[model samples]
Target: MASFKKYRVDGGKFSLASIDPADSPFLEGDEQAQRDRLEQLAGELDDLQNLLHAEGRRKVLLVLQGMDTSGKDGTIRWVFSRTSPLGVRVTAFKAPNDDERARDYLWRCHANVPRSGEIMVWNRSHYEDVLVPWVEGWIDKAELRRRYAQIQDFERLLAETGTVVVKCMLHISKKVQRERLQARIDEPAKRWKFQRSDLDVRKKWAAYQHAYEQALAATSSRHAPWHVIPADSKRHRNLMIAQLLVKTLRGMELAVPPADPSLDGLVVV
Candidate 1:
Protein backbone atom coordinates (compact mmCIF):
# COMPACT_ATOMS: atom_id res chain seq x y z
CA MET A 1 0.00 0.00 0.00
CA ALA A 2 1.25 3.43 -0.84
CA SER A 3 1.52 5.88 2.03
CA PHE A 4 -0.99 8.75 1.73
CA LYS A 5 1.71 11.07 2.98
CA LYS A 6 3.25 11.01 -0.49
CA TYR A 7 0.17 12.75 -1.82
CA ARG A 8 -0.31 15.19 1.06
CA VAL A 9 0.55 18.82 0.48
CA ASP A 10 3.23 20.32 2.72
CA GLY A 11 2.64 23.81 4.11
CA GLY A 12 2.74 26.45 1.36
CA LYS A 13 4.69 24.15 -0.97
CA PHE A 14 2.15 22.38 -3.12
CA SER A 15 2.41 22.22 -6.90
CA LEU A 16 -0.58 20.91 -8.88
CA ALA A 17 1.69 19.91 -11.72
CA SER A 18 3.82 17.68 -9.51
CA ILE A 19 1.28 14.87 -9.46
CA ASP A 20 -0.18 13.21 -12.56
CA PRO A 21 -3.89 12.54 -12.67
CA ALA A 22 -3.26 9.39 -14.66
CA ASP A 23 -0.90 8.06 -12.03
CA SER A 24 -2.25 5.10 -10.07
CA PRO A 25 0.29 4.47 -7.36
CA PHE A 26 -2.28 2.82 -5.13
CA LEU A 27 -3.82 0.65 -7.85
CA GLU A 28 -3.12 -2.99 -8.67
CA GLY A 29 -4.24 -5.36 -11.45
CA ASP A 30 -6.76 -4.66 -14.26
CA GLU A 31 -9.96 -2.67 -14.09
CA GLN A 32 -12.01 -5.54 -12.67
CA ALA A 33 -9.51 -6.10 -9.90
CA GLN A 34 -9.59 -2.44 -9.01
CA ARG A 35 -13.36 -2.49 -8.87
CA ASP A 36 -13.30 -5.59 -6.65
CA ARG A 37 -10.84 -3.95 -4.30
CA LEU A 38 -13.04 -0.89 -4.15
CA GLU A 39 -16.02 -3.04 -3.19
CA GLN A 40 -14.05 -4.69 -0.42
CA LEU A 41 -12.99 -1.31 0.89
CA ALA A 42 -16.57 -0.11 0.72
CA GLY A 43 -17.67 -2.96 2.96
CA GLU A 44 -15.03 -2.08 5.51
CA LEU A 45 -16.18 1.52 5.37
CA ASP A 46 -19.74 0.45 6.15
CA ASP A 47 -18.64 -1.42 9.24
CA LEU A 48 -16.50 1.46 10.36
CA GLN A 49 -19.39 3.85 9.90
CA ASN A 50 -21.59 1.66 12.10
CA LEU A 51 -18.94 1.79 14.78
CA LEU A 52 -18.75 5.56 14.37
CA HIS A 53 -22.44 5.86 15.06
CA ALA A 54 -22.18 3.45 17.98
CA GLU A 55 -19.38 5.38 19.58
CA GLY A 56 -21.41 8.58 19.21
CA ARG A 57 -18.65 10.94 20.10
CA ARG A 58 -16.72 12.47 17.23
CA LYS A 59 -17.51 14.24 13.98
CA VAL A 60 -15.88 13.85 10.56
CA LEU A 61 -15.87 16.35 7.73
CA LEU A 62 -14.62 15.36 4.30
CA VAL A 63 -14.01 18.22 1.90
CA LEU A 64 -13.73 17.36 -1.81
CA GLN A 65 -12.38 19.82 -4.35
CA GLY A 66 -11.48 19.32 -7.97
CA MET A 67 -11.68 20.64 -11.50
CA ASP A 68 -14.75 19.95 -13.65
CA THR A 69 -15.19 16.19 -14.31
CA SER A 70 -12.95 15.33 -11.41
CA GLY A 71 -15.52 12.78 -10.16
CA LYS A 72 -16.37 14.22 -6.76
CA ASP A 73 -19.94 12.91 -6.92
CA GLY A 74 -18.86 9.52 -8.21
CA THR A 75 -16.38 9.22 -5.37
CA ILE A 76 -19.14 9.56 -2.80
CA ARG A 77 -21.53 7.19 -4.60
CA TRP A 78 -19.19 4.23 -4.97
CA VAL A 79 -17.13 4.74 -1.85
CA PHE A 80 -20.09 4.90 0.51
CA SER A 81 -22.38 2.56 -1.42
CA ARG A 82 -22.74 0.16 1.50
CA THR A 83 -22.85 2.66 4.35
CA SER A 84 -26.26 3.62 5.69
CA PRO A 85 -27.45 7.12 4.88
CA LEU A 86 -28.03 7.62 8.61
CA GLY A 87 -24.27 7.74 9.16
CA VAL A 88 -23.25 9.90 6.23
CA ARG A 89 -24.53 13.23 4.92
CA VAL A 90 -23.42 14.96 1.75
CA THR A 91 -23.65 18.70 1.04
CA ALA A 92 -22.78 19.97 -2.41
CA PHE A 93 -21.86 23.62 -2.47
CA LYS A 94 -23.14 25.60 -5.41
CA ALA A 95 -22.79 29.31 -6.02
CA PRO A 96 -23.69 31.42 -3.02
CA ASN A 97 -27.36 32.42 -2.97
CA ASP A 98 -28.42 35.92 -1.87
CA ASP A 99 -28.83 34.71 1.73
CA GLU A 100 -25.46 32.99 1.60
CA ARG A 101 -23.82 36.07 0.08
CA ALA A 102 -25.10 38.21 2.90
CA ARG A 103 -23.12 36.29 5.54
CA ASP A 104 -19.44 35.67 5.94
CA TYR A 105 -18.33 33.02 3.44
CA LEU A 106 -17.90 30.28 6.06
CA TRP A 107 -21.35 30.80 7.54
CA ARG A 108 -23.12 28.44 5.18
CA CYS A 109 -20.39 25.87 5.62
CA HIS A 110 -20.54 26.13 9.40
CA ALA A 111 -24.23 25.34 9.43
CA ASN A 112 -23.69 22.09 7.54
CA VAL A 113 -20.92 20.66 9.72
CA PRO A 114 -21.26 17.16 11.06
CA ARG A 115 -22.71 16.51 14.49
CA SER A 116 -21.02 14.12 16.91
CA GLY A 117 -20.81 10.58 15.55
CA GLU A 118 -21.65 11.58 11.94
CA ILE A 119 -19.72 12.08 8.71
CA MET A 120 -20.37 15.02 6.39
CA VAL A 121 -19.02 15.28 2.89
CA TRP A 122 -18.70 18.62 1.17
CA ASN A 123 -18.84 18.04 -2.59
CA ARG A 124 -17.45 21.47 -3.24
CA SER A 125 -16.50 23.59 -0.26
CA HIS A 126 -15.39 26.89 1.18
CA TYR A 127 -12.32 26.62 -1.03
CA GLU A 128 -14.58 27.72 -3.85
CA ASP A 129 -14.79 31.16 -2.33
CA VAL A 130 -11.03 31.45 -2.68
CA LEU A 131 -10.83 29.76 -6.08
CA VAL A 132 -13.65 31.38 -8.10
CA PRO A 133 -13.18 34.89 -6.80
CA TRP A 134 -9.43 34.98 -7.36
CA VAL A 135 -9.54 33.24 -10.74
CA GLU A 136 -12.24 35.62 -11.96
CA GLY A 137 -10.30 38.60 -10.54
CA TRP A 138 -13.02 39.55 -8.06
CA ILE A 139 -10.60 39.56 -5.11
CA ASP A 140 -6.95 40.60 -5.00
CA LYS A 141 -3.99 38.82 -3.38
CA ALA A 142 -4.41 40.43 0.03
CA GLU A 143 -8.04 39.44 0.20
CA LEU A 144 -7.21 35.92 -0.92
CA ARG A 145 -4.65 35.62 1.85
CA ARG A 146 -7.20 36.76 4.41
CA ARG A 147 -9.71 34.17 3.25
CA TYR A 148 -7.04 31.47 3.55
CA ALA A 149 -6.39 32.50 7.13
CA GLN A 150 -10.10 32.46 7.89
CA ILE A 151 -10.44 28.94 6.51
CA GLN A 152 -7.51 27.67 8.55
CA ASP A 153 -8.98 29.17 11.67
CA PHE A 154 -12.44 27.78 10.99
CA GLU A 155 -11.08 24.29 10.39
CA ARG A 156 -8.98 24.52 13.53
CA LEU A 157 -12.08 25.36 15.51
CA LEU A 158 -13.82 22.32 14.09
CA ALA A 159 -10.80 20.24 15.07
CA GLU A 160 -10.67 21.59 18.60
CA THR A 161 -14.34 20.78 19.00
CA GLY A 162 -13.86 17.09 18.01
CA THR A 163 -14.31 17.27 14.23
CA VAL A 164 -11.72 15.42 12.20
CA VAL A 165 -11.33 17.21 8.89
CA VAL A 166 -10.09 15.22 5.90
CA LYS A 167 -9.81 17.15 2.66
CA CYS A 168 -9.00 15.72 -0.77
CA MET A 169 -8.24 17.56 -3.98
CA LEU A 170 -9.21 15.34 -6.91
CA HIS A 171 -6.35 15.81 -9.34
CA ILE A 172 -7.02 15.39 -13.07
CA SER A 173 -5.33 16.59 -16.21
CA LYS A 174 -6.77 19.12 -18.65
CA LYS A 175 -6.92 16.48 -21.38
CA VAL A 176 -8.88 14.14 -19.13
CA GLN A 177 -11.29 16.92 -18.18
CA ARG A 178 -11.86 17.72 -21.86
CA GLU A 179 -12.60 14.09 -22.63
CA ARG A 180 -15.03 13.92 -19.71
CA LEU A 181 -16.76 17.14 -20.73
CA GLN A 182 -17.05 15.93 -24.32
CA ALA A 183 -18.46 12.61 -23.14
CA ARG A 184 -21.12 14.45 -21.19
CA ILE A 185 -22.15 16.21 -24.39
CA ASP A 186 -22.12 13.00 -26.40
CA GLU A 187 -24.11 10.90 -23.95
CA PRO A 188 -27.80 11.74 -23.94
CA ALA A 189 -28.45 10.76 -20.33
CA LYS A 190 -25.45 12.72 -19.09
CA ARG A 191 -26.26 15.89 -20.98
CA TRP A 192 -28.02 17.37 -17.95
CA LYS A 193 -24.76 17.16 -16.02
CA PHE A 194 -23.16 19.27 -18.69
CA GLN A 195 -23.68 22.98 -18.26
CA ARG A 196 -22.87 25.77 -20.70
CA SER A 197 -21.13 27.52 -17.84
CA ASP A 198 -18.81 24.53 -17.48
CA LEU A 199 -17.41 25.42 -20.86
CA ASP A 200 -16.79 28.95 -19.61
CA VAL A 201 -14.88 27.54 -16.68
CA ARG A 202 -12.97 25.27 -19.04
CA LYS A 203 -11.72 28.33 -20.85
CA LYS A 204 -10.05 29.41 -17.64
CA TRP A 205 -8.75 25.98 -16.67
CA ALA A 206 -5.21 27.21 -16.09
CA ALA A 207 -6.47 29.94 -13.82
CA TYR A 208 -8.58 27.54 -11.79
CA GLN A 209 -5.68 25.13 -11.40
CA HIS A 210 -3.48 27.92 -10.11
CA ALA A 211 -6.16 29.05 -7.73
CA TYR A 212 -6.56 25.51 -6.36
CA GLU A 213 -2.84 25.09 -5.94
CA GLN A 214 -2.62 28.28 -3.94
CA ALA A 215 -5.63 27.57 -1.75
CA LEU A 216 -4.52 23.99 -1.02
CA ALA A 217 -1.01 24.98 -0.07
CA ALA A 218 -2.06 27.86 2.12
CA THR A 219 -4.73 25.98 4.07
CA SER A 220 -3.35 22.45 4.55
CA SER A 221 -2.49 21.92 8.21
CA ARG A 222 -2.10 19.22 10.87
CA HIS A 223 -5.79 19.45 11.76
CA ALA A 224 -7.22 19.69 8.23
CA PRO A 225 -4.68 18.30 5.79
CA TRP A 226 -5.37 17.93 2.07
CA HIS A 227 -4.66 14.83 -0.01
CA VAL A 228 -4.31 14.97 -3.78
CA ILE A 229 -5.95 11.95 -5.42
CA PRO A 230 -5.04 11.04 -8.98
CA ALA A 231 -8.47 10.81 -10.63
CA ASP A 232 -8.20 10.09 -14.33
CA SER A 233 -9.33 6.50 -13.76
CA LYS A 234 -12.65 6.37 -11.98
CA ARG A 235 -11.92 2.95 -10.50
CA HIS A 236 -8.55 4.02 -9.16
CA ARG A 237 -9.99 7.21 -7.73
CA ASN A 238 -12.75 5.30 -5.91
CA LEU A 239 -10.31 2.71 -4.61
CA MET A 240 -7.93 5.35 -3.30
CA ILE A 241 -10.55 7.40 -1.52
CA ALA A 242 -12.23 4.33 -0.05
CA GLN A 243 -8.95 3.15 1.34
CA LEU A 244 -8.26 6.59 2.73
CA LEU A 245 -11.54 6.80 4.57
CA VAL A 246 -11.27 3.28 5.89
CA LYS A 247 -7.79 3.98 7.22
CA THR A 248 -8.82 7.27 8.76
CA LEU A 249 -11.90 5.82 10.46
CA ARG A 250 -9.95 2.84 11.72
CA GLY A 251 -7.48 5.14 13.39
CA MET A 252 -10.30 6.75 15.32
CA GLU A 253 -10.61 3.49 17.35
CA LEU A 254 -14.38 3.60 17.22
CA ALA A 255 -16.19 0.93 19.21
CA VAL A 256 -19.57 0.17 20.73
CA PRO A 257 -20.20 1.61 24.18
CA PRO A 258 -19.25 -0.50 27.21
CA ALA A 259 -21.99 -2.75 28.56
CA ASP A 260 -23.63 -1.64 31.82
CA PRO A 261 -22.89 -3.92 34.83
CA SER A 262 -26.46 -3.35 36.03
CA LEU A 263 -27.84 -5.07 32.92
CA ASP A 264 -25.67 -8.20 33.33
CA GLY A 265 -28.37 -10.17 35.20
CA LEU A 266 -31.35 -8.83 33.21
CA VAL A 267 -33.00 -10.92 30.48
CA VAL A 268 -35.23 -9.69 27.68
CA VAL A 269 -38.81 -10.99 27.63
Candidate 2:
Protein backbone atom coordinates (compact mmCIF):
# COMPACT_ATOMS: atom_id res chain seq x y z
CA MET A 1 0.00 0.00 0.00
CA ALA A 2 1.19 3.50 -0.75
CA SER A 3 2.12 5.70 2.18
CA PHE A 4 -0.46 8.40 2.97
CA LYS A 5 2.40 10.90 3.23
CA LYS A 6 1.76 11.69 -0.42
CA TYR A 7 -1.56 13.17 0.71
CA ARG A 8 -0.36 14.75 3.95
CA VAL A 9 0.19 18.49 4.25
CA ASP A 10 3.07 19.39 6.51
CA GLY A 11 4.92 22.70 7.14
CA GLY A 12 2.22 24.63 5.31
CA LYS A 13 3.49 23.35 1.95
CA PHE A 14 0.70 21.85 -0.11
CA SER A 15 -0.95 22.24 -3.52
CA LEU A 16 -4.49 20.89 -3.58
CA ALA A 17 -4.79 21.22 -7.35
CA SER A 18 -1.90 18.84 -7.91
CA ILE A 19 -3.64 15.93 -6.25
CA ASP A 20 -6.24 14.28 -8.45
CA PRO A 21 -9.43 13.29 -6.66
CA ALA A 22 -9.88 10.38 -9.08
CA ASP A 23 -6.54 8.84 -8.15
CA SER A 24 -6.70 5.59 -6.21
CA PRO A 25 -3.11 4.56 -5.54
CA PHE A 26 -4.13 2.36 -2.64
CA LEU A 27 -6.56 0.27 -4.63
CA GLU A 28 -5.77 -3.01 -6.42
CA GLY A 29 -7.68 -5.46 -8.65
CA ASP A 30 -11.38 -4.97 -9.45
CA GLU A 31 -14.11 -2.99 -7.71
CA GLN A 32 -15.39 -6.04 -5.85
CA ALA A 33 -11.92 -6.66 -4.48
CA GLN A 34 -11.71 -3.06 -3.36
CA ARG A 35 -15.01 -3.47 -1.53
CA ASP A 36 -13.70 -6.60 0.17
CA ARG A 37 -10.57 -4.79 1.31
CA LEU A 38 -12.65 -1.93 2.68
CA GLU A 39 -14.76 -4.39 4.64
CA GLN A 40 -11.63 -5.90 6.11
CA LEU A 41 -10.39 -2.45 7.06
CA ALA A 42 -13.71 -1.62 8.73
CA GLY A 43 -13.40 -4.75 10.86
CA GLU A 44 -9.84 -3.81 11.80
CA LEU A 45 -11.04 -0.36 12.78
CA ASP A 46 -13.68 -1.99 15.00
CA ASP A 47 -11.06 -4.05 16.80
CA LEU A 48 -8.75 -1.07 17.20
CA GLN A 49 -11.65 0.98 18.55
CA ASN A 50 -12.44 -1.78 21.05
CA LEU A 51 -8.86 -1.76 22.24
CA LEU A 52 -8.92 2.02 22.52
CA HIS A 53 -12.03 1.89 24.69
CA ALA A 54 -10.54 -0.85 26.87
CA GLU A 55 -7.28 0.97 27.51
CA GLY A 56 -9.29 3.94 28.86
CA ARG A 57 -6.50 6.48 28.95
CA ARG A 58 -6.24 8.44 25.71
CA LYS A 59 -8.60 10.14 23.28
CA VAL A 60 -8.87 10.13 19.48
CA LEU A 61 -10.42 12.92 17.48
CA LEU A 62 -11.13 12.62 13.76
CA VAL A 63 -12.08 15.82 11.95
CA LEU A 64 -13.70 15.65 8.53
CA GLN A 65 -13.94 18.73 6.29
CA GLY A 66 -14.95 18.98 2.67
CA MET A 67 -17.08 20.64 0.04
CA ASP A 68 -20.84 20.29 0.25
CA THR A 69 -21.14 16.90 -1.47
CA SER A 70 -17.74 15.43 -0.62
CA GLY A 71 -19.15 12.39 1.20
CA LYS A 72 -18.40 13.19 4.84
CA ASP A 73 -21.48 11.30 6.00
CA GLY A 74 -20.84 8.44 3.63
CA THR A 75 -17.26 8.04 4.79
CA ILE A 76 -18.32 7.89 8.45
CA ARG A 77 -21.06 5.41 7.65
CA TRP A 78 -18.81 2.94 5.86
CA VAL A 79 -15.55 3.43 7.74
CA PHE A 80 -17.18 2.89 11.13
CA SER A 81 -19.76 0.33 10.11
CA ARG A 82 -18.39 -2.34 12.43
CA THR A 83 -17.39 -0.14 15.34
CA SER A 84 -19.72 0.08 18.33
CA PRO A 85 -21.33 3.48 18.74
CA LEU A 86 -20.82 3.42 22.51
CA GLY A 87 -17.11 4.12 21.94
CA VAL A 88 -17.48 6.31 18.86
CA ARG A 89 -19.30 9.63 18.93
CA VAL A 90 -20.23 11.73 15.91
CA THR A 91 -20.68 15.51 16.12
CA ALA A 92 -22.00 17.27 13.07
CA PHE A 93 -21.61 21.03 12.94
CA LYS A 94 -23.92 22.99 10.77
CA ALA A 95 -24.41 26.75 10.56
CA PRO A 96 -23.96 27.94 14.09
CA ASN A 97 -27.08 28.64 16.09
CA ASP A 98 -27.58 32.08 17.62
CA ASP A 99 -26.45 30.78 20.98
CA GLU A 100 -23.27 29.30 19.54
CA ARG A 101 -22.55 32.48 17.59
CA ALA A 102 -22.85 34.45 20.80
CA ARG A 103 -19.71 32.79 22.11
CA ASP A 104 -16.27 32.41 20.56
CA TYR A 105 -16.15 30.21 17.49
CA LEU A 106 -14.09 27.57 19.24
CA TRP A 107 -16.51 27.22 22.14
CA ARG A 108 -18.70 24.60 20.51
CA CYS A 109 -15.66 22.74 19.22
CA HIS A 110 -14.03 22.70 22.63
CA ALA A 111 -17.16 21.32 24.20
CA ASN A 112 -17.17 18.40 21.75
CA VAL A 113 -13.66 17.05 22.35
CA PRO A 114 -13.46 13.33 22.90
CA ARG A 115 -13.45 11.80 26.37
CA SER A 116 -10.77 9.34 27.46
CA GLY A 117 -10.95 5.95 25.80
CA GLU A 118 -13.35 7.12 23.10
CA ILE A 119 -13.25 8.26 19.48
CA MET A 120 -15.01 11.46 18.39
CA VAL A 121 -15.62 12.46 14.80
CA TRP A 122 -16.46 16.01 13.80
CA ASN A 123 -18.27 16.17 10.48
CA ARG A 124 -17.50 19.85 10.03
CA SER A 125 -15.12 21.49 12.44
CA HIS A 126 -13.59 24.76 13.52
CA TYR A 127 -12.12 25.00 10.03
CA GLU A 128 -15.51 26.34 9.00
CA ASP A 129 -14.80 29.47 11.00
CA VAL A 130 -11.98 30.16 8.56
CA LEU A 131 -13.50 28.83 5.34
CA VAL A 132 -17.01 30.33 5.23
CA PRO A 133 -16.01 33.73 6.62
CA TRP A 134 -13.18 34.12 4.13
CA VAL A 135 -15.15 32.96 1.09
CA GLU A 136 -18.04 35.23 2.02
CA GLY A 137 -15.74 38.21 2.67
CA TRP A 138 -16.82 38.37 6.29
CA ILE A 139 -13.32 38.09 7.76
CA ASP A 140 -10.33 40.14 6.61
CA LYS A 141 -6.93 38.65 5.86
CA ALA A 142 -5.54 39.63 9.27
CA GLU A 143 -8.44 38.01 11.11
CA LEU A 144 -8.11 34.90 8.99
CA ARG A 145 -4.46 34.61 9.91
CA ARG A 146 -5.30 35.13 13.55
CA ARG A 147 -7.93 32.38 13.44
CA TYR A 148 -5.40 30.02 11.90
CA ALA A 149 -3.04 30.66 14.77
CA GLN A 150 -5.79 30.16 17.29
CA ILE A 151 -6.70 26.86 15.67
CA GLN A 152 -3.10 25.69 15.89
CA ASP A 153 -2.93 26.61 19.55
CA PHE A 154 -6.22 24.85 20.25
CA GLU A 155 -5.02 21.69 18.53
CA ARG A 156 -1.76 21.86 20.45
CA LEU A 157 -3.73 21.91 23.68
CA LEU A 158 -5.63 18.81 22.55
CA ALA A 159 -2.34 17.08 21.77
CA GLU A 160 -0.85 18.02 25.11
CA THR A 161 -3.90 16.58 26.83
CA GLY A 162 -3.38 13.15 25.23
CA THR A 163 -5.73 13.49 22.29
CA VAL A 164 -4.63 12.03 18.96
CA VAL A 165 -5.97 14.43 16.38
CA VAL A 166 -6.31 13.22 12.80
CA LYS A 167 -7.78 15.62 10.29
CA CYS A 168 -8.80 14.76 6.73
CA MET A 169 -10.11 16.83 3.83
CA LEU A 170 -12.25 14.81 1.50
CA HIS A 171 -11.17 15.85 -2.01
CA ILE A 172 -13.61 15.49 -4.86
CA SER A 173 -13.86 17.08 -8.29
CA LYS A 174 -16.52 19.68 -9.10
CA LYS A 175 -18.07 17.42 -11.71
CA VAL A 176 -18.43 14.66 -9.20
CA GLN A 177 -20.05 17.01 -6.71
CA ARG A 178 -22.50 18.18 -9.35
CA GLU A 179 -23.47 14.61 -10.17
CA ARG A 180 -24.06 13.81 -6.52
CA LEU A 181 -26.07 16.94 -5.97
CA GLN A 182 -28.15 16.24 -9.03
CA ALA A 183 -28.74 12.70 -7.92
CA ARG A 184 -29.98 13.98 -4.60
CA ILE A 185 -32.40 16.27 -6.39
CA ASP A 186 -33.62 13.55 -8.76
CA GLU A 187 -34.12 10.79 -6.22
CA PRO A 188 -37.20 11.24 -4.06
CA ALA A 189 -35.75 9.09 -1.33
CA LYS A 190 -32.69 11.35 -1.21
CA ARG A 191 -34.43 14.66 -1.77
CA TRP A 192 -34.56 15.43 1.93
CA LYS A 193 -30.76 15.65 1.95
CA PHE A 194 -30.73 18.22 -0.84
CA GLN A 195 -30.87 21.87 0.05
CA ARG A 196 -31.55 24.87 -2.20
CA SER A 197 -28.74 26.71 -0.40
CA ASP A 198 -26.33 24.11 -1.72
CA LEU A 199 -26.72 25.65 -5.16
CA ASP A 200 -25.61 28.98 -3.81
CA VAL A 201 -22.49 27.39 -2.37
CA ARG A 202 -21.79 25.68 -5.67
CA LYS A 203 -21.66 29.06 -7.34
CA LYS A 204 -18.76 29.98 -5.07
CA TRP A 205 -16.98 26.70 -5.55
CA ALA A 206 -13.71 28.26 -6.64
CA ALA A 207 -13.72 30.65 -3.69
CA TYR A 208 -14.47 27.83 -1.25
CA GLN A 209 -11.69 25.74 -2.77
CA HIS A 210 -9.21 28.56 -2.31
CA ALA A 211 -10.35 29.05 1.28
CA TYR A 212 -9.90 25.33 1.98
CA GLU A 213 -6.40 25.38 0.48
CA GLN A 214 -5.37 28.29 2.65
CA ALA A 215 -6.90 26.81 5.80
CA LEU A 216 -5.35 23.37 5.27
CA ALA A 217 -1.92 24.83 4.51
CA ALA A 218 -2.02 27.10 7.52
CA THR A 219 -3.36 24.61 10.11
CA SER A 220 -1.80 21.24 9.23
CA SER A 221 0.97 20.44 11.72
CA ARG A 222 3.01 17.53 13.04
CA HIS A 223 0.78 17.25 16.09
CA ALA A 224 -2.49 17.34 14.17
CA PRO A 225 -1.64 16.79 10.54
CA TRP A 226 -4.17 16.95 7.71
CA HIS A 227 -4.52 14.32 4.99
CA VAL A 228 -6.38 14.94 1.73
CA ILE A 229 -8.25 11.81 0.73
CA PRO A 230 -9.21 11.22 -2.91
CA ALA A 231 -12.97 11.15 -2.55
CA ASP A 232 -14.22 10.87 -6.11
CA SER A 233 -14.51 7.18 -5.36
CA LYS A 234 -16.46 6.56 -2.17
CA ARG A 235 -14.93 3.11 -1.70
CA HIS A 236 -11.44 4.53 -2.08
CA ARG A 237 -12.20 7.27 0.46
CA ASN A 238 -13.44 4.79 3.06
CA LEU A 239 -10.48 2.50 2.50
CA MET A 240 -7.91 5.27 2.80
CA ILE A 241 -9.39 6.75 6.01
CA ALA A 242 -9.85 3.33 7.61
CA GLN A 243 -6.28 2.39 6.79
CA LEU A 244 -4.95 5.73 8.02
CA LEU A 245 -6.83 5.38 11.33
CA VAL A 246 -5.76 1.77 11.85
CA LYS A 247 -2.16 2.76 11.21
CA THR A 248 -2.45 5.62 13.71
CA LEU A 249 -3.96 3.43 16.46
CA ARG A 250 -1.36 0.74 15.80
CA GLY A 251 1.37 3.30 16.20
CA MET A 252 -0.07 4.16 19.60
CA GLU A 253 0.78 0.55 20.65
CA LEU A 254 -2.47 0.06 22.55
CA ALA A 255 -2.86 -3.17 24.56
CA VAL A 256 -5.05 -4.71 27.21
CA PRO A 257 -4.19 -3.39 30.67
CA PRO A 258 -1.97 -5.58 32.84
CA ALA A 259 -3.97 -8.12 34.82
CA ASP A 260 -3.88 -7.94 38.62
CA PRO A 261 -1.55 -10.64 40.00
CA SER A 262 -3.78 -11.04 43.06
CA LEU A 263 -6.72 -11.97 40.84
CA ASP A 264 -4.82 -14.58 38.81
CA GLY A 265 -6.02 -17.51 40.93
CA LEU A 266 -9.47 -16.19 41.80
CA VAL A 267 -12.58 -17.92 40.45
CA VAL A 268 -16.09 -16.52 40.06
CA VAL A 269 -18.81 -18.18 42.20
The TM-score of candidate 2 is: 0.97
TM-score of each: 0.97, 0.97
Q: Report the C-alpha lDDT of model 2 over 150-210, residue by residue, as the tens digit.
A: 9999999999999999999999999999999999999999999999999999999999888
The per-model lDDT (C-alpha) reads: 0.92, 0.94
Residue-level lDDT for 216 in candidate 2: 91
lDDT (10s digit) by residue, model 1, range 29-54: 88788878888999999898888888
After superposing candidate 1, which stretches have Cα over 4 Å from the reference?
Answer: none
Worst 10 residues of 1 by lDDT: 5-14
In candidate 2 the C-alpha lDDT for residue 18 amounts to: 88
